[model samples]
Target: MQRLLRRARIPPVRTAPARTAPARTATVRTATVRTRSAAAGTAPLGLLYERHGEPAAVVQLKNLEVPKLGDCDVHVKMLAAPINPADINMIQGTYPLLSPLPAVGGNEGVGEVQEVGRRVAALKPGDWVIPADSGLGTWRTRGVFPEEMLLKVPSDIPVLCAATLSVNPCTAFRVLADFESLAPGDSVIQNAANSGVGQAVIQIARASGIKTINVVRDRPDLPKLVERLMGLGADHVVTEEMLRKPEMKYIFKSTPRPRLALNCVGGKSTTDMLRHLQPKGTMVTYGGMAKQPVMVPVVSHIPQSAFIFRDVRLRGFWMTQWRREHAQDREGVVAMMDALCQLIRGGQLTAPACTEVPLQDYRTALEASMKPFVSSKQILLL
Candidate 1:
């Protein structure tokens, strides 16, 4: 990274002798001044939303002030940020984490360190980094952030991988490993099987030798979606209807009853997956794409044995909350990222299907992100 940065660095211009300016010298100095102003004089452009509403209606592209660098600050040139469901929810005033009005509207992205303040030690110019937590206002061209707020990542990983890493993939990995004591050959089930976190769950589970029963809403392109999940190492893929049918038993024949059920789509989808968990199993809810409450019966709605005797556990996770709990544990975050990076390097992990859209074309990206059955993640290139 340092070598590449050295090669790309523009040589400093030599000053002409201090004297009365000739036409050519005057032109040179004026041009130099303009170049410097362009590089550092202006504020950066960002996607800002002044009032909470539909993301498309409220979010606007505007110039944002370049904050003064503090002794512990790191100046960064953002490379890319993804349009996530949480980002949309934050814009719509639905999510728990909302910045003040006129807030820049992104929570996840990767950036290149341009310069470091005097007291900043760990991060240097040319390093790749991501926000250590959410609500950092990442949908901008540049920023001056404190060193502790940024996590330095390996420069070799793909920008899209680094940009989209902190949220979904981390969520997936944590839920899979944290909630249950899953081992090789143990089965896990999840709804919204094609989402960013779901896809990460599939890959990470596959890498760990745990089987996954992926559930998705039925669509005309079911075969194609199933094929895509299969290619990502899913053990099985089924529709919401299929999950409710008697034949769900047939799936457990190959893999054991799942000990962990991951619920992203709440309502019936959550309850249905819960029915299949092994005795003393766990169900972790992290999202509600269905805009419905998780309905669980007190009595025998699920298989009476599973409900009465199964001892099923239910829990919830919020990445922002997790970040807050780990606020001072930056080393722990770095260690987790290091493990994820190792998987990335070994091809055990990969980014979701992403559609790169330039920052100026954010409307197109935001629109596509809300459309039904859209699988590819929308990434805004800065």
Candidate 2:
């Protein structure tokens, strides 16, 4: 795995700061099915980063060498992967789960099982799969990986759905299930309402007969965003300012107060949503997009104390940690995936709005993902 080597057809190597030893141990054997890549027949190329900083600056497209396949290894021909905020954070070394330097930069993607080692059982040729854990270095043309790191998914779903499924959707599913037991007609509120997780939450909640109060920052194109989210089953889409206003009471005239508040944006945005929560409601803090400390009002303005008066519960959720604690419940994970796929097949859930870019054009995609008011997810088509 540490060898500075490439396949026989690969061109001579050049000195580069991002250059690292080729990954895994594998020699490609003659196979009946090959991945769709114009750049195939040459060494595999991946987005490699030598240091932690801005992802666009330190990452480079470089040739790779996969080592010989072990009996439990699976050779996957990469397909499509999304450029998620977590991926950017991991590249910058701010994310809790970071790959080693000179490592591939993707954390999630779907790929074809072009070949599986003799001992591989659950997956076979042509099976579409995604990584079960992070740090598999998904932003590459192909790679050989241990079988345990992969999870097979149905191919009938759209490519974008399978590619993006392993992260945001899964997170949404867990958050809804693990938190307050929300029933049909019950409502939940969330900020950053157009994010990948937010979109997933809207759809999943709708499928379960729950209503969602979606909140987003006021942007120039607010109407369009609200329309799109409402089309995806949002019961109400309000700007942060609108949520703060006294007129917010009218939003609850038709539906009940939310017992669950999903706060991805910390600071006042969280407080805005928190104020709307039903007494004893649970607020789950996930991502701090606003980059500010949460300010909860405990003064008599609310007619009672914030924490002691309302008895609102504050908690945090990290998907990686959930997976770790539930390691023994592999069956539970599979069942969740199966339920999500069923939702996809029934047309109850669809892929998030996506812009597919070929692997070589990653820089453009990464830049777009970092911009404000961005709704479409950037997917790299390998």
Candidate 3:
């Protein structure tokens, strides 16, 4: 009887509620497996904008959270970016548009991609890139943004040079390329030859076999300045003061007559350039550093072109517009940069001296950078 009880004690195995839908309904399948989210890191390094106003309004270095990534995003570690005049103006809230509050302040930097989203196919970690726009907040040690806005930079190019490339070099390219009819034998004249854009234009024109007559403010190192420019392929180097010479026609006759002139400095500087331009020539103005309106003489009028009275037929060239039209020419841009790099490597291209500083030394660096005679372009290295 005890053995019979033991057998009966073993309960029958219970079956799952015969899941009328095969033990488990499609609606009641195992819970979906979740993939891990992207890892977050410490805050990035950068200059923050606590307020809006003047240069002293509030530019400070502070740690901030790494920006969150989007589906087509790229996270970059900024190597270096320059402090251009535009940057200063932007920070002072004097520029055409002000940056958002509590934003980072810097444009034109070179960086390495540290992370990329699944949808970002073109770039990968460790690849060097730059922003298409100079004002895209490049002062940070790291940032996250859509891949479409990034430009892959050549590894051979020096980081400092890469940092300054977006604005100046691109502007130089536009000035040279726009007047396609202007040829190698023709001469182009410009003021502010000491300016970054002016220097770039001289080099580019030299490379293209075009002649350039550069006009710069007289400096203590005038001789050296002239020598440097000549070495960069300047056909003739003159001072703006020379433009007012009563014997200007006699003096200009000995020099190449400029068929195309680039004027960035308005006021008296504009008149100076106009006086040297060959009749029917075109002058393109990209800036007005003189802080005065360009004044043209009434006698400059000629029947061939009414533009003369309008001051050498002035026209403005904006780099942003040029970039839009040539967006498809990324390869071309890369090629130009590569060619410049090759020249740099071959010793044919004289890279302007660079003043290196740490990323955190922006205030001092900025002060030195804005100084008129400060040697070399101030570069903030990460």
Candidate 4:
């Protein structure tokens, strides 16, 4: 097994100061650290991990030989990749699926094809693409991957949206389309409404003429967050405290009871969200951000007049599983991507707020990603 490099730190590269610099040259010199060379070569720099551990501790910047392309393969030049929670969890060895040791560290990103094998017909140099599934190790500056493992993405779409389109937005789309037979004017309620999936849901739902009741935890910036979500087309935004109040009943007078509920934060939040669902409605659980188990109160348990009486259905959704089940359905995946890109190009969907850091400053990006209450997504730029 490959072991992690045990070096304590790798310092940033610096160039020697120029002699007799003009006053105007000072500003240009200060920005040198942020620029990167786009030249291609046998050795390229990448973020790598030889073992599972804290991202800051285990991940290191190293020079790696560019992977050689094989028949039916393409060499991709990474444009931008996001640091996601799942990427962090994979680094911690806590995710359900783990890659072999000495792995590259990102799952989703957008890249341009730099070269294609002679046998490759569908793609060529300069075409934009994204990994067909997770574990393609997208953080590197470039990689050679099998043509089948990538899906073409429109270059016209914003780089951020294209980079992130395969995961969260797709998750939101699947959860809405797969589970329920929804119609215009129908309403859905969901907690963690300030999340990436939540924002996608709000915009997608709005475009389909569906309504959304967004639930979020209260914070010092609660008002601003609510306004932001509303600006994204949420029908209503309520805090967990507001959801528990009897006054919430007034909200239903205008909007019909939610036909579906999406849960990310489990524990009390799940139970409270269930309380607002229409009888015989379905609740889909996608994440457990609160690190609490989904518990059903004994007093309102199924034996009594609770879940069974209401004919409520509980289901779980994992994007990885969905990909596996539909791996061979290439047309389906392309259609979904097309819809999302159209939404983005049409201005109906917007990428989440983001902070970009050059690939060399990954340590700072990793630290920021782990901070609590961080609303901006971190993207590593080449």
RMSD of each: 14.4, 11.6, 22.1, 15.0
Q: Candidate 3 on 1-382: residue-level lDDT in tens?
A: 1121122231111111111213321111111111223343345667777566655447777775664677898888899888777778777766544455666777677899999999998899989888775457777777777787788877676777777877877677666665535555667888988777888878877766678888888878899888877877787888888767676566456566787788888998886777677776777777777779976665533532325343345566766545555567676556555555555556545545578888767888878776775536777887
Better of 1 and 3 by lDDT: 1
- lDDT of each prediction vs. the true structure? 0.81, 0.81, 0.68, 0.80
Ranking by TM-score: 2, 1, 4, 3
lDDT of 2 by residue, 4-108 (tens): 011112112111222232455222111121222445557877888878899779888777777678899999999999998888988887776666566787888
| Root mean square deviation (Cα) for candidate 2 | 11.6
Candidate 4 lDDT, 1-382, residue by residue in tens: 0000001111111112223423331110000011134454445667888788999999987766664678988988999999989899988988877666677888889999999999999898989999888888888887788888889998998999988888889888878776677778889999989888899999988888889999998888888888899999999999999999998899999899898899999999988888878878888888999999975443565533336677777777878767766787777677677777878988999887789999999999999999876767899996
Better of 1 and 3 by TM-score: 1
Clashes of each: 0, 6, 0, 0
Runs with alpha carbons beyond 4 Å of true place in candidate 3: 1-42, 246-255, 300-311, 325-350
Compose the digit string of candidate 1's lDDT tens values, residues 1-382: 1121122231111112223323331100000000012343266778888788999899887776676788988989999999999889888987765666667888899999999999999999999999887778889888888787789999999899999999998888668766766678898999999999999999988877889999999888889999999999999999999999999889888889999899998998877887888778988888899989987655764464445667887778777666766677676666668768877888878999999999999999999999999999999999
**TM-score of candidate 3 versus the correct structure, residues matched by position:** 0.81
Can you list the residue pairs that collide in candidate 4? none
Reference-based lDDT, residue 132, model 4: 89
Screening candidate 3 with a backbone cut-off below 3 angstroms (N, C-alpha, C), the clashing residue pairs are: none
For TM-score, the strongest prediction is 2
Q: What TM value does model 4 have?
A: 0.87
Candidate 3 lDDT at 200 equals 80
